[model samples]
Target: MKRLVLVALVALALGGCATTAPYGNFVQPPVTVDQQQLAGDAAKQLAALWPPAKTRFELQQPTPDEFGAALVGNLRSSGYAVLEYAPQKASGAGNATPEQKDADPVVVVTPTTVALPLRYVLDHDAGTGLYRLTLLVGSQSITRPYLEQNRVLIPAGYWVRKE
Candidate 1:
């Protein structure tokens, strides 16, 4: 009986040594996503346009950087080169001309507090089509078309997917 108890203790110790899954591994990362605000027809469409991880995209958080870290972490996991852009305040030009010539798109995350938890402002002017994003309860992200889009009708601005 003592030998059996020892074996059980060893098994328990081994199990404890196992590493726990990262926060992002879980569907809902201990965060809250309000659904009522996210509800509507356009949310699904935005989700579809949201850039996937692994791609090289520039990031500009104009808002209070609500999900900046969390988002970058997620994107990095997917093998994306998430570059942050902080244009020189002294320069009159908002974006450098040379950078604009590149094919890589710039991602803008602007939080619309008036509509947060329901929707976030995503600007990728370099990208092309209609884009939309809505955050639902249980941290669920529902998007239509079931894929990301490269060509959007609206290139830059804080507008939801109307079409």
Candidate 2:
């Protein structure tokens, strides 16, 4: 009986871990198949405007976050190497000269949200007393980001994709 109970406990523990989503920063950005596919197209379009070199990008966060990741992933999937650029911090070596590392130019990718309606449904099985998520759609636009003049406008879905 003791051994059987231990085995059941171990199984339960493992199952709990298995249910967790995989994401390091913030919640897994709520992204759909269509969202990724459309974002991929946007990345390709942006790539064409720049010279044929590895394009580094400064993603406007929550531009939305998931959409940004999708954009970067799609850009990579499209055979282009991408890097995130952060402005170099001032080296406080007071007279210590730092090596000048040449870097490829980076473009700031910003997202602009549009209005759209997303309905969410929640269902509770009375017998189980557990609430289940039936829908994740958000009230925001599903339009992909676009470049106007010089700015890259991301869609509202990225913003409202979560909350």
Candidate 3:
């Protein structure tokens, strides 16, 4: 009886350790291009622009916190203002309370590819990691000519790079 109980306990413990959402650990499946195309397109659009002379960016994906932190660092280096991130928090049963009602304008980031590619090693072990991500730098003030000239907010395929 004692041995049987111990075995059952061990089995239960091991089963509990298994998980499905394997992030930050094992190498995930290969990320397809379709998953990350939008962000790539947005980045290409921003890269083509030469104005806003003093523009700012706000990232909204790959875990909003991580994106925001990186954007803040990048913008700071580029001499652009780094605005505060206002994460939407659950308010009640039906809606989310505004973390900051006067949140700054932001550009959203979306992970086109959620899985990582596999690599072959001497041991032939598989690994998981994140591949490229597609970001959309959208803003409500989509009027300025500089923004227009760069075709920043233009629909996809307007200036898609063929690489």
Clashing pairs in 3: 26-128, 27-127, 27-128, 28-128, 35-112, 36-112, 39-134, 39-135
Tens-place lDDT per residue, model 3, 1-163, is 9999999999998888574322221213342223122333433344455222355554332323332344344445544443444457775534534754446646678644232121110010223222222233442211111111131322322442221
Model 1 error, position 113 (Å): 34
Predicted structure 1: lDDT: 0.38
Per-residue lDDT value at 125 in model 1: 20
Where does candidate 2 stray beyond 4 Å?
1-34, 47-64, 95-163
lDDT of 2 by residue, 38-121 (tens): 456555554554332444443322233544566667666666545443446796546544542333435677544321212222
Better of 2 and 3 by lDDT: 2
Least accurate 10 contiguous residues by lDDT in model 3? 115-124
Question: By the lDDT metric, which is better: model 1 or model 2?
Answer: 2
TM-score for all models, in order of appearance: 0.27, 0.31, 0.27
Predicted candidate 1 versus true structure: per-residue lDDT over 9-66, tens digit per residue: 9999989868542121111233233222222223233334554432354543322333
TM-score of candidate 2 on Cα atoms, chains taken together: 0.31
Q: What is the RMSD, in Å, between candidate 2 and the native fold over all Cα?
A: 16.8
| Alpha carbon lDDT of each predicted model | 0.38, 0.40, 0.34
